[model samples]
Target chain A: MTPALAIRNVSHSYGARKALDDVSFSVPPGSFTMLLGLNGAGKSTLFSLVTRLYAARHGEIEIFGHNIMREPGAALRRLGVVFQARTLDLELSVMQNLLYHAALHGVGPIEARRLGQAALARAGLAERAKDKARALSGGQMRRVEIARALLHEPRLLLLDEPTVGLDIKARADLLALVRELVQEKRLGVLWATHLIDEIADDDQVVILHQGRVLATDRAQAIVVAQGAANIGEAFTRVTGVAQEKLSA
Target chain B: MSEIAAPAGFTFRQYLICLSGVVWREGLRFLHQRERFISALVRPLVWLFIFAAGFRQVLGVSIIPPYETYVLYEVYIAPGLMAMIQLFNGMQSSLSMVYDREMGNMRMLLVSPFPRWFLLGSKLLAGVAVSILQVYAFLLIAYFWEIEPPTKWGYLTVLPALALSGLMLGALGMLLSSLIKQLENFAGVMNFVIFPMFFASSALYPLWRVKESSPWLYYVCEVNPFTHAVELIRFAFYEKVAWTSLAIVFAYTSAFLVAAILAYDPARGMLMRRGG
Candidate 1:
């Protein structure tokens, strides 16, 4: 079967500065794919292109065989996105934000409420549904965003550093929920992060640096090839940078 | 990997609902912040009740076409007050856009499934709706002050003109929001674009009145798109149709909207800057 998302030779730039250069990757259905990159490695830029927030200047983005630029609505409908930024309306309650998102996707009130509640429950935010988003903690706000993304039951979920600001416990909890989503719902995921701990051995990993893909394969295989016991060293070996330089 | 189903298409009805949803949210937000609504009304109301009062004696009334014989200074400036509300609201909306961008809500809007143009159009329509409400409220207050047109039909005729003029100004706000780089620079926009656009037009004085003061200023007022917007309202309040003003308002709306869309084009790298 065709992969859930196929990106081909996508290249983008910002006025003499290249954000994404000759970047290409694909995510199979029901697979958890982690996009590993440091800051400014074009991870968010790639997400923008995939979600059709920005058109790819010289490449094609195919969401389940639909070209995003040619058929944006259909392509976007198939993909649910959780941006790195907090998209919640601070004044509105959690339920209101979810309902607004659902309406944007053309879901009616009754079904929207049902789906929204289910998604909130899955994100462990059912009780806080009536609370204002601004009243919630940072981790709770992130969970609300995840719940909003799941309202449409998208076939593919694009998360850009979803756990960026979360505590260790929150991060682990979010990752567990994401793993469950991939297995139970058979949804494809593209999780972008710079942190190596977010990756699992069995998960698919794509290493990006300076807007180019360094390697793409099973996470454990890369670690083994690099003769490293964990993903951090493996990432360093693949990107050919010292640990301190990589940290910087 | 199993094959997943393709997603459904978006409908026109869905578009309308989404537009209404966005506009309603804006209205609700506006209502929640009572200060914004009060100020939206108070700014124009102040000029009408206070500034106009101070200038009434010094500013002599003229027999403009829309007016029958000598009109009161306050009555003559009503259309300008209406335009002023829209002008200020337009700038406020632009400021809100910048704030939204800084606060991350704009990113959420950009990622929506709908076309970007549709999203921006919805926002502009919402601003226009709010401005229309302000104009009506001002008109009601003006009636109690006995400064309104003589007929009720005159009031009815002003609605569409208010909408058209509101839309034109709102589009200008949208364009400025997209083009402005930082929130700090927005203050400069108010001083340079907002004040000049309003004062240079016929908002406070008739074009002929400007001519008596300075011929060049009068010429500038006659050519300004904002002057046409005010003229549209002035004529509509008198139960008369000004097609020339109507056409000019439409033209300004189209130009500003097209420029906003182009500036906001995702691939254009206009909004690619990272926000804190």
Candidate 2:
């Protein structure tokens, strides 16, 4: 089966500073792929290329076999992305924000209304739909974003460090919420985060560091290959190889 | 589901819905900020009440074609001030674009399955829609001051001119926003741009007056797109079409919009360089 998200030798830069370098990865359908990296490790840059926020200057990105640059309309129709920043119009009500997003995706008003309500209900934000986005807490706001992302019923969902500012419980809740959807809807998810604990044993993992992909394998397989006891040690071991490779 | 569309996956109905959604959101944003409307109205009214009265005798706008008899400075400058409201509204829309880019929702709009040109066009349409409302509100108040159009149907006739001028000015703002890298520096840039464009144009006074003072200044005003905007509205307010001014404004609108769209293209380097 075609991967939900695929990046092949993608490289991007700003001025002379390289953000992503010779990076490649693929996210299989109906699975949760944790894009593990440190801050400024190019995970956000990878996400940017995938979402076409920044064009893939040097490589190809395919969403369900559709090239992002050449066929963005088709590729993006099945893709949803939640950036790390706060995106809700603070003054607009929750429902209005979702409807605004739906329209951008060419979702009709009546259908947008229906899908918006259902998404909000699924997010457990049904009661807050009429309230302004500012009224919700940070965690609640994140949930609303997830709901908005899913409103178009995308087959692939990409979230960039979505739990950055959330509390421990809120982070776990957000993770569990997405994991449940993957199981039920068979949605492919590329969840980019810096936290290691978010990874599970069977989870597919791509360890990115310093604009380069250090390793790509299952979490447990990486641990075994690197001769590490846990994912935290595996991350450290793979990232260490970067310095030697760079100096060469 | 993954079959490559011919780049026109969306139908006309989807395009309409997208356009309506953008305009609706802009309308809601305007309503939520009632102070914005008040401020847009207040700027034009200030000149009409105080500045125009003071300059009534100092600047003589004799009977021009749009005017059959001697007119008050307030009557003469009303169209310019109408243009003024749009000028400010256009700049405000650009400011919001810069703000929205930082807010991060701009990405969501861009990542939509529609063509980039259409999305930018929708945004321009929304800004023009808001500016029209502000212009009408200003006109309603100016009516009390006896600055109504020269003909009975002047109000209805000026709609097209208002939209055209608004698009031109709003497109200019979007272009400026694309050049702007941050919010902190936008105000300084707007002042340098807005005041010069407004004062040097035919907004507050006619080009003939400037020609009498300085030939170079008259040439400056002649080249200023804002002059055509003012002339277009002034003639439309009198229920006549300023064909030359109409052509100039239309040309500027097309140029500014095309430049803004190109500046925003992902393949280009302007906005992405600014991290927008």
The model with the greatest DockQ is 2
**All candidates: TM-score:** 0.95, 0.96
lDDT of 2 by residue, A1-248 (tens): 89999999998888789888999999998999999888888887788778877778798999988899898888988898888999999989999999999999888878998998899888888889999999999999999999999888889999999998889899899999999989988889999988888899989999998899999999999999999998888887888643223211
Candidate 1 scores an fnat of: 0.46
Whole-model lDDT values for every prediction: 0.84, 0.88
Q: Residue B67's C-alpha lDDT in candidate 2?
A: 88
Clashing pairs in 1: none
Expressed as tens digits, the lDDT of each residue in A95-169 for candidate 1 is 888878886776766788898888888888889888888899888888888888878778889999988878999
lDDT of 2 at B118: 93
Clash number for each model = 0, 0
Q: Estimate, for each residue in B1-276, the C-alpha lDDT of model 1 and write its tens digit.
A: 222453366777778778877887788778777888888888888988999999999988779787778988898888998988988888788888888876767766666778889888888889888888878888888888897776888888988999988988888998889878689988898899878878998878877778888999888888788899999999999999888989989999899989988877776545654322
User: Compared with the true structure, what per-residue lDDT tens digits does model 2 show for residues B1-276?
Assistant: 332333448889889999999999999999999999899989899999999999898988888878899988899899999999999999989998888888887777788888888998999999999999999999989888888976679998999999999999999999988888788867776679889999999888778878999999999898899999999999998899999999999999999999999987888848668555
Worst 10 residues of 2 chain A by lDDT: A239-248
